[model samples]
Target chain A: MLNIVILGAGNVATHLFKAFETSESAKVIQVYNHRLESLSFFKNKTEVCNNINNLKDADLYLICLKDDVIEDYASQLKYKNTMIAHTSGSFPLLQNIEQSGVFYPLQSFSKFAELDYKNIPFCLESNTKSGIQLLKKLAKEVSKQVFEIDSKQRQTLHLAAVFVNNFSNHLYTIAEDICKKEDIPFDILKALILETANKIQTQSPKLAQTGPAVRQDFKTIDRHLSQISDEQIRRIYQLFTNSIIKKYE
Target chain B: MLNIVILGAGNVATHLFKAFETSESAKVIQVYNHRLESLSFFKNKTEVCNNINNLKDADLYLICLKDDVIEDYASQLKYKNTMIAHTSGSFPLLQNIEQSGVFYPLQSFSKFAELDYKNIPFCLESNTKSGIQLLKKLAKEVSKQVFEIDSKQRQTLHLAAVFVNNFSNHLYTIAEDICKKEDIPFDILKALILETANKIQTQSPKLAQTGPAVRQDFKTIDRHLSQISDEQIRRIYQLFTNSIIKKYE
Candidate 1:
């Protein structure tokens, strides 16, 4: 079994901890957080450390902190030649460290939801060839797809992910808001949501686009806008519609 | 089998034809299109007609024309009180014809892609009680969820669908464009896309949202924007990021 130590207790950290716990080939040797309360959940299976000095020696160290604090955390941990990894998409592999990499799971994680990692793509990157191979082997235990992506590619993927996932969910928020304001049942729009996602899986977004905006049907667009009283939603509808029309043409 | 005559040979018409063909309770008896060439696909199973005068008698006449031409086509149909219906989300029950209603499948249709209607939601509305019952029965054959939604509610749902599906998809298109320009593979973002959808299914979109934009991380946002060379994409990213930040705050 691979010896692993997870740092931080945020969503990504919690998810990684639980996922590794379930994996046959990996075992959490230790858990570390700046605060003792954050490491409380992993108290039974592994040793929890609040003090930086008490950080145990492990084969691999996975840093699951926010992007801004990754560098600081890496500098504080003085383990030489240890295979260190961060789970942030935007941050690059640490250059100052002798052996460092990224283990970015390209998915939205929540504490409540049970994540199925079978289809979840793991983007792995390391400075050393053996480190990459080891990371790839660990990734293979959970995920069907794994890529040895550099920091630049991961950044681009993260940006694209923001557009497809984050921005898309925001649009769903806008839709839910509109439905609530109009006193329409939100369930009425559920199937359409699933269909839209399925369509993208088969066809390109350019070919799959529909609505008054794509047709340039100003009358229908005006009618739709007139129904909504929210200024932000109206502006969003107009701006996005215009953007789509411009992009496709 | 319930004999059904479909009017118009557009995307909706073709989709309905394929759906009804698989439906055990219903069979398409005839198809009417302004141009006879469009009716070629349904020739074996349906009696194709270009002229309304040649329209055959059927249990139901489904008008599947565009919103602009629906009224015009509805006015020309010789058949009346034969469970006539229009496939539109915005159009009201036709008061001009007896037993007229709507059979709106609340999803986008594409000719190239095969649609699985088992989970697709269908919104049914009719002027008469019997018409509503028949439409509900017909819808139940193809979908698990069927609701009696009036034109007002459907219009609201349609508007919301535009936000959730159309606008959300435009965001995906933008992200894809950005990724393409940056030489990033679009599949890298698929895991995020699937997870985002799954997240919204359980939690509110507001709670499920995550990104540099939502967190108002100007440092990363500026960094991402600087990397993009396309003027249009940069503008879109900036505008959307600003909107998301504003919404969250």
Candidate 2:
């Protein structure tokens, strides 16, 4: 059995706390967050602490806080010998603490969305071999995918994730805005969005590329730009179109 | 059964022909293309002809040609009242032909990909009410989703589809490139990509948005931007990050 303490109450923290509670091999000994309201969700299930100084002794201290505060929290922690890990994608395995590791799950978490922990890939790294082994066992308890990624590779993965999730969703927002201005239902484009995301699963995204950009149809490209009056969006369209043309042509 | 003839054997034409063949109410009697190789897919399944002048009598003639050539194809067709319609999103309802309409299915179609016709939204419009009614019946035979969209709305939908499908896929390609360059397996981000796409189905794209940009985390954004060395991709990241911050914050 593994003893765990989650230090944060944000989306990732809450979701991880819920996931840990259900694991027969793991127990959430405590949950610590700065705000009392944030800690309310884990109050009944485990020992809740609003202060980091009051963090109880546990086998692992999983810091799910912001990147800026991670080093501060780890350095401030009074507990010794207990393994300290962060769930950050960009942050390195060790910063201010002597004993540190990473248990980064490469998936976006929302408070309302229910994620199956078994499906999410857990990217793990550590300052020591024993720390990594402990993280691997705990991660294997929840996720079938356990990757021993170094800090540099994890950082690259984080950057790539931003492009896939953030930039892709931004494109959807633009499409939604365009639909609203034209009094068109956005639901009509939902099938296209789903198909676009699903295509890359089996095929390479480079091969799956399509549209006026890939075809280099200048007339359609100009017409599409004319339709969008927003300068930012038009430039985005042009830039992406140029990139696609450069890639294929 | 409705007798349908498909002109032009491109990806769209091939997929639509296969879909219509599965329907008991619709029979695709002829497939026409300027190039003999393009019509080869429909050779054994239907009457394949390289000459448009050899077009046979049919209840509906679908000009599944490219947008630039749809007008020319419609004008050259020998049929007069056979309810001519083009399978184009941006193309208007009327062309040089007397009886023309739009049979735009707002979904990305690939020749090799298996598409569920029932889930795809079919947008229909015509010059006459009877023409639209005929299209609605034909569309209903295969698809559960049917929308009576006008020329302007279809144009807008096409533009939106560009953003959602074309632009979204471009971002995925970029991410794949980043992953390939970093020696990281692209499968790591597959779960995140699937989650981002699935979240927008139940929630608005606006609500589904997340990342350093959406959160307005400048430090993380700068860190991510630093990780990317490609000037074009860096600009893309910065531009998209700015857009997200502008939209949300």
Candidate 3:
């Protein structure tokens, strides 16, 4: 079994700790965080440490900290043979570390939310070939989907993720806001939202595309624009409509 | 059992026909369309006609035509006691028709796509109380979720649906485009897409929102913006970033 040491106690870190704990091939030996309060979740469950010097010698040191502190935290880690891998999408692979890699899971994680780990795509990158094999093995323990992605490809994936997850979710928030303003239950639109998301699983997004914008239904577009009073939202509606029209039309 | 005559053999009409076909309380006696070719699907199962003048007598005359032609199609229909309800998101209830109402299902429909009819929200509007009761009965037969929404409220719901379904799907398309250009397998992003969509089912969109924009991570945002070459997509990135930041920060 591969021994793992997790750094940080954020959403990704907590989820990873649980995932590793359940895997027969891998086990989380210790967890470290700067704030003693944040380490309470891992307390009594594993060897928790507040200082970087107290980190246990393990097969892999999975750094699940924020993007800003990853480099600093990794720089401070003094390891002999243990590979250091970060669970960040945008952050690059650490250069100074002797055995550095990336173990980015391309999924949003909330501490309380239940996840189907098998479906998550783990993007792995490493400075050495053996490091990648180790990362791949650990990733395969919890997930069926795994890819050996470089820093550039992973960064691109991160940007694309912003569009699919962040921007699309903001669109849902906009819909919720519109429903609230009109005294309409936001629940009514939930089915449609789920259906739209499900459609692309089987069909290509290009072929699955539908709406007044794609149809170039000026009448409906005019009506919708007239209804929106918010200047920013109206502009967003127009921008998205134009973007879709430019591509399809 | 209530007999219904469905006009227009499009996506909405076909889905509704199938939904009602399974219901013991309602039966579609006839389907009408301007083109004889479109009515081929409903030929053997039920009475079908190309000519609008040949519309059979039924308890409800459901006009499932395009928004622009709904009024003209309803005007040609000569009904005695049958209530007239048009299945549309944007089109309002027919003003001049004696027994007019809206039977709009606030869900996107494709003729070939399979749907979960029970989850679909059917929004009903009517001129007469009995017409509403009839619609409520028919709607409840196929779907558990039904609401008595007026034309104004239905219009608002339609607008919200566009934002959530249409706009969000467009964002997915954009992400797909981004992934394709970068030589990254688009399949990798699918898990993240499904997870983001699933989160809102239990959590509010506002609280479920995450990413650099919400986190105000300008360094990562700049890196993403620099990587994107498309002018419109970059602008969209900036616009959405600002919008999200404005809301959360």
Candidate 4:
């Protein structure tokens, strides 16, 4: 069985800990965090540590901290023979280390949100062949989809994720705001929102694109713009309309 | 069974035709389009007419034409003891007519795309009480969801729909473009996209929001912006980041 020490008690770390707790081939032997209060969730469940120097010896040290502190945190880990992996999409594969790899789960996570890690694509990268093999094995235990993505590709994926997940959700928020202004139920647009996301799963987003902007229906666009009172929202609307027109027309 | 004559053969028209075809309470008696080529799909299955004057008498006359021509087309149709309704999100309920109503389906329709009308909300509006009852009955035949939305509210829903569907799909296209440029398979982000959409079905978009912009991770945001070579995309990234920060911070 693989003994894994999960560092940081954030969304990714807590999720990873639970994912491995049920796995027969792997187990989270210890969880480390700088704040003792943050590690309260994993206290009774596993070995929790507040200090980085007090990390338990394990086969793999998984750093699931913030991107700003990942490299520094990884540097502080003192291990005799262990693979140190950081779960970050933007960060590159660590160099100048004996066993270093990246194990990034390509999905957004909230502390309270329930996630199905089975379908989540675990992007694995390693300097050594053994490190890659170990990550692949650990990833397969929790997920069905696994990919050998390099740092460059992973970074690109992260940007793309922001566009699809973050930007798209922001659009939904805008829609909700518009509905709230007119006393219209935002639930009406929920089905269309879900369908739009589902459509691109099979059809290309370029071909699946629809609306006044793609059709260049300036009349409707003008009408929509005139109704919006917010200057910021109007600017966003115009920018997106112009962008869509530039792409198609 | 209530007979219906559908005017204009477009995406909305085709989908509505297919939806009502299996409906037990409603049957499409004839489909009319100015262009004979466009009516080819409805040939042999139902009565097809090329001229508006040749439209057969029915209980309901449903106009499924372009937004620009819906008013003109509805004005041209001459019928007795029949209700008239147009399927448009942006267009207001037909006025100055004896029996006028709106049977707008609050979802984007593609001619070839398979659709499940069961959950699709049908926004209904009419001038008379009987007109509304008829529309509600016909709408309930194919869809489980039916709402008596006014012209003002329907217009607001249309604007909201543009944001959730069209604007969101454009974001997906941009993400695909970024992935293609980096030789990264866009399929890797599909699961994340679906999950983001599914997340909002229960949680509010504001609460569900994540990533650099929401977290105000300027360091990662700057890194992402520096990597992008496209000026328009960079501007969009910066604008969205600012918008998100404005909302969260």
Q: Rank the candidates by lDDT, best first.
A: 3, 4, 2, 1
B1-249: candidate 4 lDDT, tens digit per residue: 899999988999999999998898899999998899988999989999897778888999999988888888777764455788999998988776789999999998877889999979999999999999999999999988899999989988998899899989999999999999988888888999999999998989999889899888888999999889988888888888999899987
lDDT digits (tens) for residues A1-249 of candidate 4: 899988889899988888887799999989988889998999999888887777778899999988888888777763446799999999999877789999999998878888888989999999999999999999999999999999998999999899999999999999999999988888888889989988999999999999999988999999999889988888889999999999998
TM-score of chain A of 2: 0.96
lDDT of 3 by residue, A1-249 (tens): 899899999999999988887799898999999898999999988999998888888888889988889888887774555688899998898997888999999999998999989999999999999999999999999999999999999999999999999999999999999989878988898889889989899888888888999999999999999999999999999999999999997
- Ranked by DockQ from best down, the candidates are 3, 2, 4, 1
Model 3, position A97, has a per-residue lDDT of 82
Of 1 and 3, which scores higher on TM-score? 3
Clashing pairs in 4: none
- Candidate 4 local Cα displacement, residue B48, angstroms: 1.8
Q: What TM-score did chain B of candidate 2 earn?
A: 0.96
Q: List TM-score (chain A only) for every prediction.
A: 0.94, 0.96, 0.98, 0.97
lDDT of 1 by residue, B1-249 (tens): 788989988889888888887789898888998898888888887689999888887889999988887777777763554888899887777877877889999888888777787877898899889999999999988888898988888888888888888887887787778777767767777666666776776677878888888888998898888878877667767777878988889
What are the candidates' interface root-mean-square deviations?
1.6, 0.8, 0.7, 0.7
Backbone clashes, candidate 1: 0
Model 2 chain B weakest 10-residue run by lDDT: B73-82
Off by over 4 Å in 3: none
Whole-model lDDT values for every prediction: 0.83, 0.87, 0.90, 0.90
Error of 4 at A227 (Å): 0.9
